[model samples]
Structure formats: structure tokens, C-alpha cells
Target: MMFRRTAFTVGLLALASSMYSHAEKVEWSQGSGQSDGIVVSDGANNNARTAYLSISSAISVPAIKKTQEEVSTLKRELAEVQRNAEEMKRQLSTQQNQAASGLKDSSANLSKEIDDLKRENQSLKSALDDVKRQQSQTASSGSSNSSNVSREMDGLKRSVEELSRENDKLSSSNDRLSQRLNDMDRSLSSLESKVK
Candidate 1:
């Protein structure tokens, strides 16, 4: 649109210049027609048209310059916006990576906790088996010094019972930890969805 307007203005200026030149040529051709003949009126009209065309063309120059400046400013602003958006995307990517790292750390910690619990469970099972073996041996052997051994066996039985209780508690704790870890995973997935 601006191009077409500028072209039209230029065309008018060209036509005005042509008319002014033709008028000058006619004035030169007829010596008396130069100042005091019908050619004089024609020259006046051409000169006036040229003047108006120049003024209008002058007006269009500033408008064109302003339009170009505005375009350049808009281009600069668009570049700035693009730069800001890219920076924001970079920051977001960094934050997401940090969140993922935190999740991985939490998962690793949970896995370590699970492994520790499993080891504790195995230890308790082994202790229980040893206690059972001792009881079997004591029961099968009819020795004279059995009373003291039986009392000691009672202490071992109580220790085994306590270990069983602790194992049960650890199992329940592990289940809750597993559930919490799953919940954390779900929450992270939800957070990722919202970010996208």
C-alpha cells in the first residue's frame, strides 16, 4: 500500500516535470511567446503544478522516512521479543532439568531405602531361623543342665519376637514409602503436563 502511494506521488512529480519542461521549450521556440503570449499562461500553469507536486512530494518524503523508521523499529521490537522468548525457554528448560534431577535423586534415595529394608528383612529372617534351630536343639537334648539353657532360650525367644515386630513395622513403613514415591511420580507427571 505504501509502495503504491509513493509510486503515484513519483508519477505525478514526473508528469509535472515533463509539463514544466514542455512549457519551457514552447517559450523558447516562440521568442515573443516567452513572456507575453498564450505560452505564458501555459508556463504559469506548469510552474504552479510543479510547485504543488514538489510540496506534495516533499510531504511524502517525511512520511516515507517515518514509515521506514517505524518498520525498522517494529523489526527491532520483534527481535527483542524473540530474544526474550528464547531466554524464557532456556530458563524453563533449566528449571525442568533441575526438577528431573531432584526426582531422580529422590528415586535413588527411595531405592536405597528399599534395599536397606530388604537387607534388614533378610537379617531378621536369618536370626529367626537361628533361634528356631537353637530351640530344636535344646528340645531334643535331655541334658542335666537344661534349666539354665531353657532360661537363656526364653531370652532368645523374646529377642526373636521383638525382631519380628520390628520386621512387621519395617514392612509397613516400606509399603508407605513405596506409595509415597508413586505419588511423587504422579505429581511430577502432572507438573510436566502443566508446564507444557
Candidate 2:
């Protein structure tokens, strides 16, 4: 009985293998020395190679499109950044020009102020020289005036001394006149007595 069972199992396995082999069909054509073939299989059996190729392409198509969109967005952003940089450069140039103009005006004002200061300094020097010259002239004139005052003082002192001597002479003359009057009165009185 065991031998019969083993033979039955072997027959079944052989039949299933034959059916599996028949289900796969391979047809080939020869072109010169090269060969091309078509491989067909049962529908129930999935082909890993074909499935992988189809799935990978489906995934890759969308991924490539997404990559292109991302690149375009990046490019636009880069262009905007470049434009902003250009605008900033222009603004900076304008500011620099304004600063230069302001500096030039300030320099001109400072130079004019310096010229004015130089003129004022020269005028002050001229006035100082005139003052010095006037002071010297005044000093010389003061010396002459001092000499005149000294001479006037000396003359006045001499006049005062002469007046003092004249006063003494007048006093002596007055005393002599009084004495003569008194002697005349006495003589007259004696004559009167004799006559009597």
C-alpha cells in the first residue's frame, strides 16, 4: 500500500510541473546573428521585472516634475534677490553723492571763513599799529607840555617873591610917613605957645 501511495504522489507532481512549464511561452526570432524573444506567462504569475519598471517610472515622472517646479521657484527667488541688491546699490550711490556734496559745501564754507578771519586779523594788526603810533606821538607831546608847565611854575614863583619884596617896601614907607606927621604936630604946638 505504501508503494502505491508513493507512485501516485510522484505522478501528481510530474503533471503539475508539466502544466507549469506549458503555461510559460517563449518565442524567438533571429535577425542576422542576434536573437530577440517574447516571453509570455500565465496571468496568475506576476512578473517582478515588468512591475518594477512600471512602478519606478510612475514614481519618477511625478518626482521629476516636482523637481522642475522647485527649480523654477528657486530661480525666481534668486532673481528677486538680485534685483533688491541692485536697488540697494543704487540707493547707496545716491547717498554717497549727497554726502560728497554736503562735504564740498562745508569745505567751501570753511575756506571762506578762513579768508574772512585772515582779513579781520590783518585789519586788527593795522589798527594796533595806528594805536602804537598815536601813543608815541602823545608821549612826545606830553613831554613838551610837561616842560611848559615847569617853566610856568618857575615864573609864578619868581613873581610871588617880587611881590613879597614890594609889600615890605610899602610897609616901611607907611611907617616913615606916620613919624613925619607926628613931628609936624609937635612943632606946630610949640609955635602956638610962643605966640601966646
TM-score per prediction, in order, is 0.63, 0.47
Error of 2 at 67 (Å): 0.5
lDDT of 1 by residue, 1-196 (tens): 6677668766865665575665533321222423211222255345422133222333456778999999999999999999999999999888987787787789779878988988888888888889888877877787688788889779888987988898899889889888878877887786577567
Tens-place lDDT per residue, model 2, 137-185, is: 5555656577765665565556545545554554455455445545544
How many pairs of residues collide in model 1? 0
lDDT of 2: 0.53
lDDT of each: 0.71, 0.53
Candidate 2 regions exceeding 4 Å error are 1-53, 56-59, 143-196
Angstrom error of the Cα, residue 119, model 1: value is: 1.3
Residue runs of model 1 more than 4 Å from their true location after superposition: 1-59, 142-150, 184-196
